[model samples]
Target: MLITKIYKPAEVEKAADELRKGELIAFPTETVYGLGADATNELAVKRVYLAKGRPSDNPLIVTVSSIEMMEKFATDISDDARKLIKHFWPGSLTFVFKIKPGTLSKTVTGGLKTAAFRMPENEVTRKLIELAQVPIVGPSANSSGKPSPTTAAHVYHDLEGRIAGIVDDGPTQVGVESTIIDMSTNKLVILRPGAVTREEIEEVLQKKLDTDHHEVGKDETPKAPGMKYKHYAPDAQVLIVEEGKWEAALNWAKKQPYLVGIMAPGIEEKTLSKNFVFFDLGNNVEQASHNLFAGLRYFDDKKDVKWILAAGFAEQGLGIAYMNRLKKSAGDQFFID
Candidate 1:
């Protein structure tokens, strides 16, 4: 087993040194923590998949410190893409583009002609990439099919002793993944919804973007992560509680044979029975999005919690991203009675 070190925000140079040595390190983004590896080093990239138990065919996102670094592999940047990058590059948006022929290995691109690229809003991580002198492949730093890690400790919980180090920069703000748009073709497809909403991207481009590209066939490779696999699920069964259904959901929860977890915004703790464990989702959808993954992780430690009744939001803005992950965690199961 490898000794996994936690690097303080001041110790990014040491973390970069690990990446230079072709090691796996988990680093924070504006979204979730991402498993970092030298994108040009095929062996290092393969180890990332092995460490996360991720399917090799689900392509990883290449994180760059600058547009020039992205230009090293990504080809045919469109005017619209440039516009989005100019506005959102150092933010929560990821773009999937055609790669320059043979610039990235099939390991990174998953045997596809295109790859996903992003320049995270986090300065420490960007500096780590700049110092390492190579783009890094950054998949969410967690075990496959689990909720993405939102804090350095969460990464250590899932990946301790399996990775080299973690750059601890506190909890992530977005608490979910970036919005991924496929600019590889002219259609401009949204492969995943995230903190960067389609409405925001459309507002930037002055044109409506396509969002119906998430479905993939059994044998097909996905254009971006989260499209082709069951993701963000916890060990406990999660049942989504839609709006106006909390009363019914809680009542239903009271009768379950096993302990139930309540993840919502407004419920008073005193009103609940001992069978229910409450996790606050905060006052609004933004708070819910920020706390969704952490709440899911919290209940995972409570071994007796067999079911999580999480609140659901309307599919708009960050709600779209929140519900996307919540739906996956719940396996699309909702409280019906």
Candidate 2:
């Protein structure tokens, strides 16, 4: 497949037209680039699965231009969820609600009663969704089990031959997935943490948010799109060092006999051993989030690295979301030492 590059409005519109005709279009979002297809079209949505080789059991998040567009896909929007939508829509927050029967494709919803939906803040993606006049089912642009794409270049690298077009709007700002909240129940359950922190959501709802991270075994059924599988994994093994153990962790890391990768903040890259590849992204949480995936991808591609060692962040605020992704990527291999 030809991966057509689009930078202008007219080009984006042409690409949107192609999407309306059931062609796959990869576009940028504030969080990550998305592989999009017309949500209402079963065949178009199916192409997204074929292109990404994503499991049918995993659902896709539908991106719309406005609340009206979201209404078309959802059967009922709860009062608590509506408050979140009013504030967090056009941002990096996805709400999973009951789907309107026979309105959206069953494949897009993964044969489940609930569908994940969001309206992205990215102008290009919002415009494309509006111009296409259909909800777009968007999963991360990379093939399943790989790092999510935060830059258009990442998208091109992973999906060049698998998709039709890519909108190169530069690197994403948030550099993480959306906060997925299930509003179907009276209480809000955080399915996945991202840019919108749980505190932020709980403050608005005036209620505590439920976060269940227990993994169901392979024999058990999955409750959400990201629950059952190991996702966002790099080619190399990743081990996260617990908080208050950075110095010991670094000492232990330096003594390792194999090539290693370390993601640290405010540390001079040159100070680390020449055998180590250090990803220094400043001491701020924002900068760390932006560089996390890129650093993982870098280590993943290295020929000699045995594993990647990441220092843990504070468990408060956005740090919670950051650690969630790290834990998911590391899975059963995660060690607190």
Candidate 3:
């Protein structure tokens, strides 16, 4: 097994050196801890896929510290993309642009003509890229198909001894992935929804954005992560329940002698039976968004939990992102009342 060191904030220079040497480093971002590598270095980029057990076809996001750096890697940035970048970059949004030829690895692009780019505002990661003198493809630092980690410790649990080092800066502010938009063509389409919502982007661009269109064609490769993948799923079978079908589902779950985990918006444990493990995500949708993945992972760790019964949310603001991840993880096990 590989030895992974957890470094404090002051040791970021060392982390940069490790990155420059073409090794993996798990670092925090506004959204989540990202397993980062030199984007231009083809072999180093491959190591990210190797360490995360991510499918080779899922493209990675090349992160930059500045707009100048972003321009170096992507060309023909549209006015709308620029407006979004100006307002949202160095924050939690990613834009898919036509890549500057030969500037990045085919592995980083996943053999696509365009690549997604983000300029994360996280100080440690921004500086890490600056110090390394190369762009870093920052994917969620977790094993593929698992909950996206929101803390440094979660990264360690998933990637310890697999990567080079971890820049331990504590939990991320936004507990989801970056919002992804494909701007390679004039008509932009959202590839993945995340902390950045479509309403927020529309507010800045003064134009309604495409909230759909991630359906993967038979022979077409997905342009971004989460577009054509069943991700963030725990080992337990996740079943999405209709908004008010809790009692019916509970009765069905009780028939089996296994533990049923219930995830809802409020304190549900007080009313739950012994065979049920209750996870109250939070009082509000934002709080629910923050706690969603963590709750999933928590329930999955409970050896008694053989099935997960998750509640669905109305698609609004960040709720859209929360539901996107939830539905993807739930697969076809949706129970519509």
lDDT values for all models: 0.94, 0.82, 0.86
Q: Please tell me which predicted candidate would have the highest lDDT against the true structure.
A: 1
> Model 1: per-residue lDDT, tens digit, 1-337?
9999999989999999999999999998999999999999999999999999999899999999999999989889999999999999798999999999979999999999999999999999999999999999999999999999999999999999999999999999988899999998889888899989999999999998888644688899988999989999889999998899989988888898999999999888888988999999998999999999999999989999999999988898899899999998988899898
lDDT agreement of model 3 with the native: 0.86
Lowest lDDT 10-residue stretch of candidate 1: 208-217
Which residue pairs collide in model 1, if any?
Answer: none
Clash list (residue pairs), candidate 3: none
TM-scores for all predictions: 0.99, 0.94, 0.96
- Write down the TM-score for model 1: 0.99
How much does candidate 3 score in TM-score? 0.96
Ranking by lDDT: 1, 3, 2
Write out the backbone clash pairs for model 2: none
Q: Backbone collision count in every prediction? A: 0, 0, 0
Model 2, residue 185: C-alpha shift (Å): 2.2
Q: Rank the candidates by TM-score, best first.
A: 1, 3, 2
